[model samples]
Target: MICIDSISFSFECSHTVLEQISCQIEPGHCLAILGNNGVGKSTLLKCIARIYRPQQGRITINGAELNSLSNRQLAQLLAYVPQHSNAPHMMVFDAVLLGRRPYIQWDSTSRDRQIVSALLEQFQLTSYSARYLNALSGGERQKVFLARAMAQQPQFLLLDEPTNNLDPRNQHEILRYLQELARQQQIGIAVVLHDLNLAIRYCDRFVLMKDAAIYRQGGPEIITPQTIKDVYGISAEIIEHQGARLIVPQMDHITKAADDAKTTANHH
Candidate 1:
């Protein structure tokens, strides 16, 4: 389990990015860090990943303090995928094999090779194993990055806008896979997502942020239309369809109603 306790951060002495933030990433569950852009959603993830250290408070993995762990030890416990990744001129297989670096003593063993190969198959990148990462499309490259993180066998995973490059179909597929991965492996996952529907559907918990502080954090029940309007500064409506709840922005709903009225008037 990863515990974030009353952490605060700032790039400069002034202009705090996050203030008094606290949350928990529990094993076997996926936590979605959600808010409007520039509200410190990404900054919070960076703090947890240790890419940016919080100036105050503490974070711990199980019983070990985050700052106490060495780089190699931390890598063995947590894996993070950023919002944007550069596609380097490296083979797909080699890129993923790099995730095993924390464990390799002098040379990689057959076990490391097996883990990389299995991840390639799991992520459906086995055929692209020989291809260069720079040669693949954006969506494909994103998958390779995710597979690399999974290869680390970390107890916790952190991802930022992981579906940014994927089409609608791939978006759902990847999120669903992550949900399952967390449950099956008992790995705690914290993902930053913009789509509320996707977050409500796949994530086990939600942390809604406003102005760098969490406005609310709980299960799917907390994602009401009122909360959406409060966080996003737009009116929305939550409706159920096919045994699932969906969020529709108020403007879209109004436009659709107007269109229907126009069609009826034309028929009359």
Candidate 2:
């Protein structure tokens, strides 16, 4: 289990990004971090990944203090897939194989090659394994980066908008794979998501952040229509279909606001 206890972070400009945020994530469960833009979702993810340090808090991994762990030890326990990815002029296969660096002992091994190959095939990137990452599309490159993270075989996976560049089908496919990885391998996955319905469908746990703090955290039931209004400042209708919770934003409400603005403009 990873326990975040009263963590707070601020930039050098004195703008606080995270404020006393606390949450717990365990193996075999996928936690979705949901919030509006600039609500410290990415910052919190970076904090958990140790890329950003908090001023006042302690993070524990499996009952041990995170700060006590060395760099290599931390890498073995945690892997991060960023929202935007940049790759060098190298083959995709070789790029993914880099994830195995934590386990490699100064030389590449057959197991590393096998793991990279399997991930490429799993993500349907086998044909592009020999292609340079710069030559691939944004979505394709995102898939390769995810493949690399999985290749790391870490205990915890931290993703920032993992579905950013994926098509609808691929989004579902990747989420399903991530859930499977959590259950089958007992890996802890914490992902930042913008789509409420996708979080409902795939995530078993939820953390709603607002104003740099955790506003709510629980199962899907915590995601109420009012919650949407509070978090997104938009009216949404959550309906049920075939035993699934679906969130549908009330576009008419937005349109009404727009019409009101237009009326005020005409009057002026």
Candidate 3:
């Protein structure tokens, strides 16, 4: 299990983004971090991945403090895919191959190439293996970045708004893939997401961050109607059917109905 104990973070000139936030990410589970904008969802992921240092508290992986591990050692244990991809002017195959750098020594090995090839195929990017990343669409580039993260073969994967560039079809496809990946590989996966329906459908764990702290954290029950109103400032209904929970956002007032009522009152 990965434990984040009372971690807080801030910038020198900005306000504190995270305040004593703590959570556990266990292997063989996928968690979705939910929050409105500027609530520090992305910053929390950065702190876990060691991209930004927290001012207070500690982060540990299986009881080993992250501070004790070197950069290479940390990379060996976790892989992070940011919200954006800044792939260099290189072929897709080569870009994905870079994830194996921590394991590669002296020169590229056949095993390295084999792993890269297998990922490309799994993502349906085999046809674009020779194409440059710059030539692909935004969604394609995002998928390539995800493939690279998988190539790392780490114990955990951290993703920030991974579905941003994907279409609706692709969004579900990618999330389903990650769901299976976590179940099959026993890897802990944390994704920062705003899509409540998708989160309920795909993830086994939920952590709802609010005002720089965790407002709620648990399973599907945490995403109740009142919880939605409290966290998102909106009314929503949760319905279960066919072995899945769906969040149906409630319409506050229907303008057409209001207008009809007004017309009826005027006639009366």
Candidate 4:
């Protein structure tokens, strides 16, 4: 389990990015964080991943403070996949095997090789294992990065925009794979995503953020038209398709009229 309590962070002489944010993510669940650009979605994930320290809050993993864990110990518990991954012109298998660095002292062990090979096969990268990272396509590289994260065998996984550059098919494939991991391995996954429809389809729960603070959180049932208009400043229509909720943006005319009325009232 991961617990975030009143976490806040700010850059030097800059405005606060996160403000008193708190959330608990249980094991075997997938939580999706949704927000507009520059709303600190990535920052919150970084804090949980321990890349950035919170200025005024506590982050605990399984009742232990995050700061108390050593680097290898922390790596054993959590694996993080950032938004952008640039490989060092190395073989795909080599890059994925690096996830086992915490376990290997100096060189790759037999167990490490077994895990990496299994992950490569699982992600359909075994054929490309010998290929360099720079040679693969964008979607292929994304899969390699995800494979690296999975090779860590961490209980908790944090991903930042896992499907940022993929087409619809690859995006669905990647997210479906993640869902399977959470359900089968009982791994806790916290992902930052921009597509509300995708979040509604794949995520077990949703965390909505606005202006650097949590606006609301719940399942798809709680993500209504009012919530979208309030949190995203846009109107939308929600529909159910085969048990999954789909959010469709309403035409801008209605929203524009509402904004115009408000503007006229303010001038008056």
Candidate 5:
């Protein structure tokens, strides 16, 4: 498990991004970090990935302090996929094989090659294994990156907007895969997602962020209509369909405002 204890981070310019945030990423579950843009969702993930160290507080992964761990040691336990990745001219197989660096002493071994091959097949990118990353579409490249991260076989995985480039079908597929992977491998997974319904449907855990801090953290029950309205400032309804909770946001707010303006003009 990854325990974040009162971690707060800010830029050197005195602009605070995350404040006293605390959460946990438990094994065998997929935790969704949900919030509006600029509310420190990505920043929080970066904090966990060690890309940005919090100015205050501490983070411990599987009973080891994050600061005490070496870079290779940390990489063996946690893998992070960012919202965007640069498309290099490297072949897909070679790119994913790079993830096995933590385990390789001097040269790549057969086990590393096998892991890369299996990941390519698992993500349905075997045909594209020889293709360069820069030649693939955004969605394809995203899957390749995910496959590479999984090749690391880390105990914990952190992803920022993993579905950013995916279409609807691909979005569902990827999230489903992640959920199952967490269950089967007992690996902790924390994903920063903007799609509320997708988070509700695919994730078993939730962390709702507001004002650069965690507003609520719990099971699916914490994601209520009122909470949605409060955090997102949008009116929405939660409905149960076939034993699944769904969020239906009211899309007529703009039209209602326009009608109210017309009524005021007529009275004037």
Candidate 6:
């Protein structure tokens, strides 16, 4: 399990990007972090991955503090997939092999090769193992990166906007793979998602951030129209479709009406 307490961070004296954020992510569960642009969803993911140090908070994996872990130790515990994937011009197999660095010595071991081969097959990248990273399409590269992370064999996976560059089908494919990983391997996953529909469909729970803090968090049932309007400043309608909650954004007609009402009240 990963536990965060009173985590906060700010850059260059600006307002805090994350404010006293705390959450518990348990094994075998998938969490989706949802927010508008610039709401610090990615920043929160970085803190969990130990990429950015929180000025005031503690992050612990299992029972050990994250700050105490060495780079190699951390790499073995957590696998991070950022929004953008840029790999060297090497073959896909070599790229995925980088995930084994934490386990292998200076040279690749036979076990490492076996792990990579297995992951390539699992991600359906065996056919493209010899292709260079630059030659693959965006979705293919994303899968390669995921395979690289899976090769690390980390207990937890952190993804930031992982579906940003993929088509709809690939998006579903990647998320489905993540869900399968959580069930099959019992790994904990935290992913930042912009698509509310997909988050509702795939995520087990959600953490909604606004104004540099966690505004509300729960399952999809708690994501009401008022919640969306309050957090996102946009009107929306929520409905249930085959047991899943669907959020549909509406135009700002009520906003204009409210403004007109305020003007009339002031004139009177």
RMSD, each candidate, Å?
Answer: 5.4, 1.5, 4.6, 3.3, 2.7, 4.1
Deviation from native of the Cα of residue 239 in model 3, angstroms = 2.0
Looking at model 2, residue 102 earns an lDDT score of: 85
RMSD of 5: 2.7
| Candidate lDDT (C-alpha), each | 0.93, 0.92, 0.91, 0.90, 0.93, 0.88
Please provide TM-scores, in order, for all candidate models, with all chains considered together: 0.92, 0.96, 0.93, 0.92, 0.95, 0.90
- Please write out the lDDT profile of model 4 over residues 96-167, one tens digit for every residue: 999998788988999999999999988889999999999999889988998998888999999999999889
Encode model 6's per-residue lDDT on 173-247: one tens digit a residue: 889888888878899999999888888888887888999999988777667788877777778888889986788
Q: Given candidate 2, what's the lDDT at residue 26?
A: 88
The local distance difference test score of model 5 is 0.93
lDDT of 6 at 224: 79
Query: Which one wins on lDDT?
Result: 5
Which lDDT tens digits does candidate 1 get at residues 71-149? 9999999999999888888999999999999999999999999999999998889999999999999999999999999
Off by over 4 Å in 1: 252-268
Per-residue lDDT over 54-144 for candidate 3, one digit per residue giving the tens place of the 0 to 100 score: 9999999978999898878888899999877677999999999999988988888999999999999999999999999999999999999
Give residue 217's error in model 2 in angstroms: 0.5
How high a TM-score does candidate 5 get? 0.95
lDDT tens digits, residue span 1-268, model 2: 9999999999988888999999998899999999999999999988888889999998999998989999888889999998766678888999999999988999989989999999999999999988999999988999999999888889999999999989999999999999999999999999999989899999999999999999999998899999899988889999889999899999999899889999999999
Model 2 clashing-pair count: 0
